[model samples]
Target: MIHPAQSLRTFIGSKNFEESTRFYQTLGFEVKKINPGFSLVKVSGNLCFYLQDYYQKDWCENCMLFLEVEQLDAYWEAVKILGLPEKFKGVKLSEIKKDDWGREFFLHDPAGNLWHFGEFFD
Candidate 1:
């Protein structure tokens, strides 16, 4: 079995590295490397977003990544300033319904990847 504290990594397939890099950069990711067919963007400590060239068989549906932040409104505001699409449908700051755990909202990236941002108001 895998340890709970073990670091996890995610890879995203992209046909265009420049566009992918720019999109992630708008979401506050720092570009760490840029090559002809691959690029790395740092999301946080020990967490990086990998963008690889898309081939016919290598392309797979991208996965959703969640980011936890303290302030949802401020973060969303900054995201707005970055010119990301506000395509959030059923999620809002005022109406953040929480489960037994905490409150959360989801934002969809240009590549149809969902990013959940949650705050634990416990």
Candidate 2:
């Protein structure tokens, strides 16, 4: 039997390093700079990823992340109130939609990376 891993981290690419960092911070994620070109972003203690000041159009556009939240409706409301789409170029937000598995809202970052904020049915 395989043992469970302690933690897992994904590397995310950013087109404009400063803007991307600011974007994540604006979304309420904690960001800790590692160096000039790389940083760490955390939504919670156990959930985090590496944000790199690097970009490949194909990779950035195709990348997607699904983040499970406790209260998706409230989260969506907060996101809407932020007016991210108006503040950041290329940012887009979608209404909450229900599917077989759960309900979710969509957000596309400035780099065109898609994020699904969802809540699974209990």
Candidate 3:
């Protein structure tokens, strides 16, 4: 017997491609292609996010994307250069404590989508 395959890709709805592209780029994602009213962002390994224009008031109400990284400090520093919300104030770089599971951080996209950056140390 064979187990079911894991997720192949995640397609998300977006009303603003330009803003969404910028947001993902800030998180280290590279654009794979751009078509009419749609854009593809490469997140990792076989994971890709396809953003398409849609008519919805709350598209990300129950959606969240988590990215796994190797180094939290370096990734955080790079994101800092891209600018973050003031809520992150007083959060020292070294103070980025790691939980029992791993190191992580939260961020909001321009379209009000919540994202989590997680790091697994072995």
lDDT of 3 at 11: 68
Task: Check candidate 2 and list the clashing pairs.
Answer: none
Q: Identify the leading candidate in terms of lDDT.
A: 2
User: Can you write out model 3's per-residue Cα lDDT over 1-122, one digit (the tens) per residue?
Assistant: 97898656666765466666666675678876678767787777667877766535476544677878778888877777765453232222223557898888776665555567779878
Better of 1 and 2 by TM-score: 2
How many residue pairs clash in model 1? 0
Candidate 1: Cα lDDT at 80: 58
Q: Estimate each model's TM-score.
A: 0.69, 0.96, 0.72
State how far residue 89 of model 3 sits from its true place (Å). Answer: 17
Q: What are the clashing pairs of model 1?
A: none
2 against 3, candidate with superior lDDT? 2
Task: Identify the runs in model 2 with alpha carbons over 4 angstroms from their true place.
Answer: none
Candidate 1 structure quality by residue, lDDT tens digits, 1-122: 96677566677765455666677776778877777777777887867777766633223334567778888767666765654554322212223446677777666554455577777766
Cα displacement (angstroms), candidate 2, residue 39, comes to: 0.4
Return whichever of 1 and 3 wins on lDDT: 3
* Poorest 10 consecutive residues by lDDT, candidate 1: 87-96
Error of 1 at 47 (Å): 2.5
Residue 42 miss distance in model 3 (angstroms):
0.8
